[model samples]
Target: MSNDNCTSNVSQSIIGVLDVIAPQIAKANGLLFWGVILVGVVVGIGTYAPRYRRHPLIGILFVAATTHFLPIISSVAASVTSTELLIHTILINDGLNSRVYCTQYAHIFLIFVWAGLVMMVAVNASVIVVGDARERRNIGPLKAVTGAVVWTTYLTISTLVDLYREKVATIQFIEQRTVANVTVLGQLFLIMYTKLIFKYYAFYKAKHSFAHGRSPSLVDGYMDQLQQLGDNSDTPTILKQGEYTEYDARLHPPALIVMGEDNAQVDNQPYGNRLKWIPGQGDKVLTLDRVWKLDDMDMLQSPSAQPKYLVFSFTLFKLLRCRFAKYTISSASFTKTQKFFRYTLIKGSGAAGERAFRIVVDELSFLHDYYNSSKPIYYSHHGFVIFNIILSLYTIGYCIYLMVIYIVLMAMGYHHSQIYCSDECLGEIFEADFAGKYSDYVQRPPSPVPCDTHADLIDGSKCTSYTILTWHIATTVFEVQQNQQQHDKCPHNVAATHLSRYCAYLVACYPELLTDNNDEWCKRLYEDAKKEAARVLSTPRGATATYPLIVDLLSTQSTHSVLKDGASLGKQLVDSGMGWEPLARFWSEMILYVAPSENLEAQAEAVARGGELITLIWAMLSHAGIDRK
Candidate 1:
């Protein structure tokens, strides 16, 4: 009887204490619940706003912080309401027992919050995928959708399980279970959120470092090593002081430097003009102090060995670790975890390694563009073209096949006339130049044949019937003359000259890539031109020569002379009153049409070795939609 009385007294004392504490706990929880809601709304707006979205790290942190807070708030509210019910049973109902209420309200509230979070995740994922696609990034839509769906399903399942546990469990069991589960989940949330925070912090550091004009620590170190390597290398430069490198300079004789000519203009010339000799530029010529050699091309092409630690990879690995190993003791494995933590905190985030990688990539891209723009003369690698071929195989193959068909048709006596100029005088010149041995190369098809005609010219027969090669040379010579006559620079002439010379280079070096007949004709023309040049040089009058003098000597040569074809062609063009501007435009258009579009691999290979004129033409043709597959 005394033991029972002591137990009753102890129980009554516990009830009295609970009665005092329960109301205070409810009041505090009510404040906390409203506080969490207020904080969540503010954080949501702050995170999702456009201004905050730009700083992804801040946005991620806000989301993670809110997520962690919500679970704790729910747990507290459950405890508060349960204690209130117990107090009502003991005090208001006048019962000797206190009953714990099921945490159904808290479970429902959590489910709703998680549902909203799932939707937010889906929306964010969609936005990211669409945004990346709009920017031409290779983000697979299906992969993004799958990832979103899986994450959403997982969250939904967890929420549903919490709700089920509240419904089926006893009040005492539910209270104990909810507290333990919430505690574990909150800890897991913190670990996961902390990992994400660090990952984004790395990204933040990388981007900020770059924006501030400082190389990321990782990139700076790598660059230092690269500079050291370059300094230690024994590679020779292409051009020393006082040496001039001309455009297509390898094929031609060293330029004759005329005395007493103004040389000041040469030094201020642009990059393109630096490779060619100005017609009137005197003894002081354009020279390179230092130039990239063919060996440099190899070095440029070689990939850098710098470590690339992306924030995305870090985040992904952390997430996987949390998902698979969160409950396992192995998640805290000593050596590997310590190493990873040290590496990420020190080597990875120390200087924004990902940003450094991106910087390297961007610099490499700029170097590529520069290399392409300058047009390299030689290539050291044979397989360089393979990359281009693989990228545009069908387009390249179709272009090659079309070229072959056109060549075959031309060889079989089918001819196409020039479309722009329908001048009768030009026709007469073409007829006279190709009249004898080259008659087969220039044949006039019957009436109603396709030909380019001026709007004002009613007669199609007035269009010239010269081969494409003849038109190329005539326009090139005319453009060169016009460029010399004008003091101001003509961009069209510059383009025409470079393209024409590149075409000539192709004919001389890679004849098999062109039509067989045209290749032979170009070879014959080059040989004849060399002989005529030698003959003209032998004459005392030709000792001091200009391009015009050379043209005159070639034009006046007899029909039986080796340069008779070029002579007649040059004379006819000179006699025509049409200025060089129209001719320059004609050659520019003609080269675009005539340049071999086949084998982008070959062109890319050329570009990798240096820049390639063929690659430029190919790119232009693509832009103009002239060579669609």
Candidate 2:
């Protein structure tokens, strides 16, 4: 055949083939691209739509910035390859610069770009999926093995595809040389960024949790012990510290009440300035009900005070040991308030083993105000919700548009085309692609570095592997030590106001527990529990049920008597040479002054109960010391 005729026929054939595939390819690419974006939309909505609108906007911006990278390439390719002459017919007949040649090249480049984007996004999504799966499944070694196998399969497939594309397609830039050269560099940078962000978030959460007292789990391991004592115990003696219930409403007449005090402040006014520490302030003393003698003018001048332990008996006393209620009151004619508390005490074995305690707090009158039908004068949280919904809808629409454009570009041969020069190019692309994934990789929180390196490395298998210590681990260790020293009052610097108070309180309360003696005792007890198949509290973050055992002394009649006996045993405990004496002081610091509750009557009751418990613990300690002698 003549060369001209051969070229002409080939040109026609190429044009015919290109025309058939271009439209279908474009459609498929468009669908796939949009599908991913739609997935992102679902993710954004499902994860963040319920949040404020500002969050949605920011999330959309982030996903749009990150996910649209691949689609953008497709858009650029589509625009460049629009000319009709860029079809295969021109390539065969007119040569490389013709419209067909240019179209073919553009189509090839576009394919690689789109493929890179798809793979990267798919991998990232897979990472999130894998994380969620691991979290939900909470699987062990077997699943981990399975996951490893799957990972290996993916890597093998990726490597093989990368190699194949390099050999087959001339546009092997992404999978080969481009990926390899830049992956490690990208991974290193990403890791640093993640570390900083994680640290900042962790610090914020820890501080927040401390400020707004974290909730203590009701079902701690101590629950079973406490319940056992509560169930089998003797009937408790109920006690009243002051007037159990007497209300004289004539003290502050209804007509004399100030309007400001009577009117509830519900205007949604901001409570405190930024610099003011409002949340941690002590409770205000509000006068609720009082009685004034009509004849004695001196009674009005003197302060009519309630008992100090009044609040503790009402609430916290219930959680500690059982209590004994002892009632005795003065017959004085001066002004007085009514208070009540319930106590249950369990008698321990022997004269010295008796234990008693309380968990209640002091009571106070709580005034409940009726909601008035005045027009509301506050900003609604609903407005932010509405804004978020609108923002999410806009994001979804924008994402859909990008998907369609990407699909068209992919159809025109801009992705997965057989084009690129060398093996080096293929290597670069694969590494770059793999490294791109490192951006989303979150490293597990760094564990404490093992001081006993030999023991850690030489397990039952006796394998020796040196573990690398992370900077985070090192920093956390230092911070923990600093916290410890602060608690110890070594520097005597009250630099941390609220934190310092708590640290001092903890130190004063658990001085023994913080020392080597308590550590040794706890270690033995914990180890024994492990060996005995007993349920012991494990200090795992997020899963830690409750703190370790807290001793209660209120229940036992033996405890009550010992407390009664402690009046004598106190001198004996002080006389004993054993170091156990200091514990009495420590115990005093720890168990005293539980947080005041908002219940007035309940608070007074708890305080009374708590006092009974305190008396009981003291007796038990005294008896214990005497027995040791």
How many clashes in each candidate?
5, 116
TM-score (all chains, Cα) for each model: 0.25, 0.22
- In terms of TM-score, the best-performing candidate is 1
Model 2 lDDT on a 0 to 1 scale:
0.27
Q: Tell me the tens digit of each residue's lDDT in model 2 across 380-419.
A: 1244345435544643554465467558646854334422
Stretches of candidate 2 off by over 4 Å are 1-10, 50-166, 170-629
- TM-score, model 1 to reference: 0.25
User: How close to the true structure is residue 222 of candidate 2, measured as C-alpha lDDT?
Assistant: 19
Over 327-368, each residue of candidate 1 has an lDDT whose tens digit, in order, gives 211222222222332343224463654543343233333323
